[model samples]
Target: MDPAAEGTTTISPQLAERAERSDLHTLGIEEEYLLVDAVEPRAVETVDEVIDQVPEQMRASVQHEYLRSQIEVASPPQLELSSLYDSMRVLRTTLADAAGRAGSRLVAVGVGPASGPNSRLVDNPRYHRMRERFGDLSPGQGSCGTHVHVSIPDDETGVQVLNHLRVWLPTLQAATANSPVFGGHETGYASWRSVMWERWPTVGPTPYLQSHEQYLTMIADLQASGAMLDEGMLYWYARLSASYPTVEIRMGDVMPTLDDAMLLAALARGLVATLVQEVHAGAVAPDVPHPLLMAAHWRAAKDGLEGTGIDLATREPRPAWRLLRQLVDYVRPELERHGDAELVTVLIDRLRTRGTGAARQRALLAKGTPVAGVVDWLARTTRGEM
Candidate 1:
């Protein structure tokens, strides 16, 4: 044999172990919201006042982003499905109450209702430095989204789990699509947040990687090239968490209600858990390329469910509603495993019929009311007072 051939190793062992236990389900929700003055339609920075007035527990979990107009609410790590929903509901309620005391409201805007030069950045020193470093990354402007974290055993599983999820993320965005307008202009995108985010360094589909080592190598390469500062900047459409041992689904635009938020979180957790199980059982998944998925994502941002979406799996055009219905049934077993079938059914019925938050926002804007109505509507829906 040749010297080079004799020296090379043919195979690599498993980078990590499969998650053995089934009761390992853990979930959390991250809600990015806008702080709005009840009287003004624009975003305002009020995190300080809101946090100060809220209960101590909430104050601890609620954090400000680079923009003062934006605040992120994180649900406590939850072992049970009900607990996840409860934490989200309670947090929203507490924040709403606090906003009331401050003469403001914690409004959830996908892409804010109104936009102008009046937006205020959050006043934290760290945020200030962040704004300086990453000028446009912060919401010093306006846009919001919902992120769901589902804990996995380790990084290897996280990569495999996120790879499987990349295809359907655009589908989720189409179903949850909101943010028809941006900067107060009718941009014509169903989810303007998706469009606005393309300006960021990392906001698109992730290429298929076969194993954990391949995934790590790609990440290391990106970091070495100075394209990314660290693992934290690997903001692929669906990605393994650089910090948490969880998979983060960052597709859905900020929803107006707690029920919608909880439902989305449940779906995310269930999907990840099911995929993790399948990968553990020696299942080999098919390739869904990033370029094709990016096209689908663009369609989702432009038309939402109102237009035909580019199917990532088939590489063809299909109706958004048809695709969504199929996924609901396809994921039924997983939903059942998580004891969330009932809630999933309710969400499907509502989403399938009403279109999405973007559709509703368009209707409200057409009714001759000002953007303030949109802000109030969001506040009401989130508190379940609608």
Candidate 2:
């Protein structure tokens, strides 16, 4: 019998069982950092050397990125927000110390502030193939980001969450906007990395999917198209994980501080949990138009939190903070369920008062600080020394 016709769906038994056992709002975080010359403060091709110095226990968690100057560290799935924060702090401190010992510094900025002609590709076959295929578009691909994964029951629920969560992704991007300066020039857009990243054909808001079968079919179609290299290259802002039973939110820039990264994770978890509960309660996913969603994403990328964001529901302009508050209210129940309500509130308040990382960088520049000073500040802030 057809699984869909039987109302059982196409989920594998293993996936269904794992989903049943999964803890809602369980978190996993992946952050990419750029290695820069300690004194000169420019992106340097030293990830290979720095990875060798990582502790043996963390070797598996730390991995190379597409660029030679970049390293990405991932945390095991975490159940508590505080534990996730602690794990990230340890990883950042360890990686920074290792990079410092190797005469480099790890900067968590979204894009390399001083990336120049010297940046090189990581010596990997896949990266080589990408460069060969993409040509000029592949050389200057050193942008970094923070990916947040929230556990869900199964692919069916995951697809539903993805559809419901699409409208709020722009708000998340605005909250974590950090990449203002790239290649030593003010890019005008707050998160310049967002602009750079969307150059890939598949890296944007996904279409509203009706089922797990539809999601898989879409991936299959994209892979069949020569535009995509593989299923792994489905770099949508949010998607069901290819290797894990979680919905991965990939819209935010690499936040400069551990606090910012944790804030993003908390919000992501809350959003996913809220959506799952709604699905259980028979709420249909919002049928928002794709172009409007893409426009919202573009507005968020261009303005960040400094300006207006497209209100997905109204399809009208609104203050970024106002939209952000709407998101918080929408997910407040989930936040409370996870004991993260107060923490998220406090973090959002702090972000408003201190401004985002991009705003902070602009403030330094406004005070007549050089680009190098901005880079130095980012390095110190990322290391928790500032």
Candidate number with greatest lDDT? 2
The local lDDT score (0 to 100) that residue 56 gets in candidate 2 is: 87
Q: What local distance difference test score does each model get?
A: 0.72, 0.84
What candidate 2 gets wrong by more than 4 Å, as runs, is 1-23
- Candidate 1 lDDT over 239-346, as tens digits, reads 765555678787778888766777677778777878888788866666776567788899888888878787777888999888777777777787887788888888
Superposed on all Cα atoms, model 2 deviates from the true structure by an RMSD in Å of 5.7
Ten contiguous residues minimizing lDDT sum, candidate 1: 1-10
Tens-digit lDDT track for model 2 on 1-386? 00001111123456455545754457788888888888986788888889889998877678888788888888877777998898889999999999988889999988887757646777777777777876656445378888888888789999998999899999999988998898788889899888888888888997899899999999899878866777777888999887777898988999888878888999999999999888889898788988898889889888888899999888899999899999999889889988899999899888888889999999998999989999999999999987
